[model samples]
Target: MRIGFGIDFHQLVEGRDLWIGGVKIPHHKGSLGHSDADVLLHAICDALLGALALGDIGMHFPNTDPAYKGIDSKILLQRTYELIKARNYRVVNVDSSICLEAPKIKKYSDQMRSIIAGILEITGQEVSVKATTTETMGFVGREEGLVAYATVLLEPVKVI
Candidate 1:
């Protein structure tokens, strides 16, 4: 089995929509980025790529590329999974977490799990998502931005 870890952070802005793990959350501020800026999804994509040693998200989807402007993060996630499958590796499970100071996300955690699982073609039970605060420290604690971290376990696909 191969283990990979990834982390991503995005600044919060007033105009953008708050998207995490493919679920849109009602919030006053959203993550800022070249795309839809779903921090959780981005982190997961990075982890998947890392597991296969295929480089990080920025390498595959550069911010300078105009085609990615305002793109939905779910598409990026799908492409990343396709890369993993092409390498003959499949995700066994994934664990991820988000750091944010406001907008308690417990109610939406299950939905996020389902969305992520669907994109990865895995069972919901195989994906885990958690959220926490920074206790009034750093950018997350200050509500200036949010961060996400993901770890994944990958193994060769069984040809049963």
Candidate 2:
């Protein structure tokens, strides 16, 4: 099995919609970026890419491209998975964490897991989503931003 890890961070700002793991959460501040800025999904994408040594999300989905402007991160995740499949690899499982200071996400984690699993065409049990707070410490604790980390295990596709 191949293992890969990734992390992403986004600044919090007013007016943008808060999206994490493809779920839009009610929050006063949202992650700012060229796309929807779903940190969880972005990290997952990077992890999948990294597993294949394909580079990070920015290289595939450059912010400089207008085509990705205001794009939904879920689409990015889908494309990333496609790349793995094309390389004859399949995701074994994925574990991820989200760190933020406000708008507690415990209640929304299940839905996030379900959505992520569906996108990856994997069982919900194969995907894990967790959330935590910074306990009033750094940028996240100050509610200035939110971050996410993801790790994935992949295996070569078995041929019949």
Candidate 3:
């Protein structure tokens, strides 16, 4: 089994829609980025890519590319998983955590898990999503932005 870990952060700004783990969340400010700025999904994608030593999301989906501008992060996640599948690797499970300061997200955990599982073609039970507050300590606590961390376990598609 191979273990991969990834983390992502995005600044929060007004006038953008907040998306996390493919779930559109209601919030005063949204993550700022070239894409829909779903930090959670981005982190997951990075983790999957890292598991295969394929580099990070930016290498595959460069922000300078207009094609990815304002795109949905869910699509990115799907494509990342496709790369993994092409290499004959399958995700055994994924665990993730989102850290923020405002607009509690406890209620959205299940939905996030479901969405992630669907995209990864795995069972919801194999995907775990969690949320936490920064306790007003740093950038996340100051409400400047949000961050997400993801770890994934991968195994060969077939035993050799």
**Top TM-score: which candidate number?**
2
68, model 1: CA deviation in Å? 0.4
Per-prediction TM-score: 0.98, 0.98, 0.98
lDDT tens digits by residue: candidate 3, 1-160: 8899999999999998999999999999999999999999999999999998999999999999999999999999999999999999999999999999988888988999999999998999999998999789999999999999999999999957
RMSD to true structure for each model, in Å: 0.8, 0.6, 1.1
lDDT of 2 at 5: 97
- Across 5-82, the per-residue lDDT of candidate 1 in tens digits comes to 999999999998999999999999999999999999999999999988899999999999999999999999999999
lDDT string for model 2 (6-32, tens) is 999999999989999999999999999
| Cα error of candidate 2 at position 63, Å | 0.4
Query: What is the number of residue pairs that collide in model 2?
Result: 0
Clashing residue pairs for model 1: none
Which residues of candidate 2, in runs, are more than 4 Å off?
none
Model 1 stretches astray by more than 4 angstroms:
none
Q: Which pairs of residues clash in candidate 3, taking residues 3 or more apart in a chain or in different chains? A: none
